[model samples]
Target: MTIKKLVEQIEAKKSFLCVGLDVDLEKIPTHLLEEEDPMFAFNKAIIDSTHHLAVAYKPNTAFYEAYGLQGWRSLERTIEYLNERHPDIFTIADAKRGDIGNTSTRYAKAFFEDLQFDSVTVAPYMGKDSVEPFLAFENKITILLALTSNAGAFDFQTRSLEDQELYKQVLQTSLNWENAHNLMYVVGATKAEYLADIRAIVPDHFLLVPGVGAQGGDLEAVCRYGLNKQVGLLINSSRGIIYASQGRDFAEAAAASALSLRTQMQQILDAR
Candidate 1:
């Protein structure tokens, strides 16, 4: 999906919520396991229940890869279902992948062409050559990992080089890459304080922010600094929404949790 369409969805729904479909078999309802594809079933229920409240759905690749071929198949079915059923809703393959030039192109093709995800998360550690391949695709976004939610982010992301943080440098340098306009960034909500500075650098690109719900990041603080003229933020809530209940009413419970967050987002937008 184009960024314009993404922004339109956010406006139409009054939400920028991105539901993270990081499904764990053990945590899902026991009854779903009876189905041939439990992961896809769980995802379908969640998406159906909360689709109206969210503008995006992100399925982290690790969850599918863990189960091997079956898991991979489940991921494929889930994306196909979304594309077929709700084409307007943005889809992301949260497969934080980046490698050498040729390898990165193949990875990009796998997610962008074969799977047909609208966007994929990428790592920037390998520099421009590794990431440019993914950015080369038209209408597909390459969401680069910037300041992350994990505690270990300080080990490298925040480190100083010539008195500037490494994450800032990544944001600055990435702008010069090929098709850089298609770039969005992953800025953890836990690092909300750094957002003002981040916005000053990019100013207009979208940010896929994780850590708002389960990770205890403040939504108000993130919005205060993260929101741009176009409302450029995709706040994700994974465990907090999807795992709201493991019982038979899991999908309903997920909808309730999503509604709570979406309502809060509406209030934030109204206040602005």
Candidate 2:
């Protein structure tokens, strides 16, 4: 999906919520484990229940990869199910993949071609060459890990080099690349104060913000500084939504959680 399409969906739905599918088999309801493919079964239920409330669904690859081949198959099936049933919903493979040169191309093809994800999170630590390969694909976005939501982010991202924080340098440098408009960023909502400065650097690009809800990042603060004319934000809520219940009505509980976020998002859009 193009960024235009993504923004359109955000407007049409009156939401900018991106539901994170960080499914842990151990944490999912035990009843789902009885299914032949528990991971996919759980994901299908979540998607079916919350599709109307979300503009995007991000499946964090580590959740599936942890189970080896069955996990990969489940991931593939889940992506296929979404594409077939809910093509309008933006899909993100939260693989955080980046490698040197040719290898990066293969990784790009695997997700953008084989699995057909609309975007993939990429680590820009390897510099431009490693990330540029993912940008070669049309309408497929490279969500560069900038200021992340984790505690580890301060170890390097906040370090000043050449009189600017390293992540700020990344935002500025990435804009100069070819097809850079196809790029979005992973900005932790926890760093809400920096959003205004980050916006000054790349005002138009969409920001895939994690750290809301369970992580306690304030949604109102994120919008106040991060939002642009196009509603340039995809606020994700994973555990807070997907794990809202551990009972047979898990999907309904998930939907309710998603609806709560969507309701807040609609209010934000209206205020804007």
Q: Please provide TM-scores, in order, for all candidate models, with all chains considered together.
A: 0.98, 0.98
lDDT by residue for model 1 (1-272), tens: 79999999999999999999999999999999999999999999999999999999999999999999999999999999999999999999999999999999999999999999999999999999999999999999999999999999999999999979999999999999999999999999988899999999999999999998943348889999999999999999999999999999999999999999998899999888
Model 2 per-residue lDDT tens digits across residues 48-80: 999999999999999989999999999999999
- lDDT score for residue 173 of model 1: 97
Query: What is the lDDT for 235 in model 2?
Result: 94
Best candidate per lDDT, number?
1
RMSD of each: 1.0, 1.0
Q: State how far residue 27 of model 2 sits from its true place (Å).
A: 0.7
Residue 181, candidate 2: C-alpha displacement in angstroms: 0.8
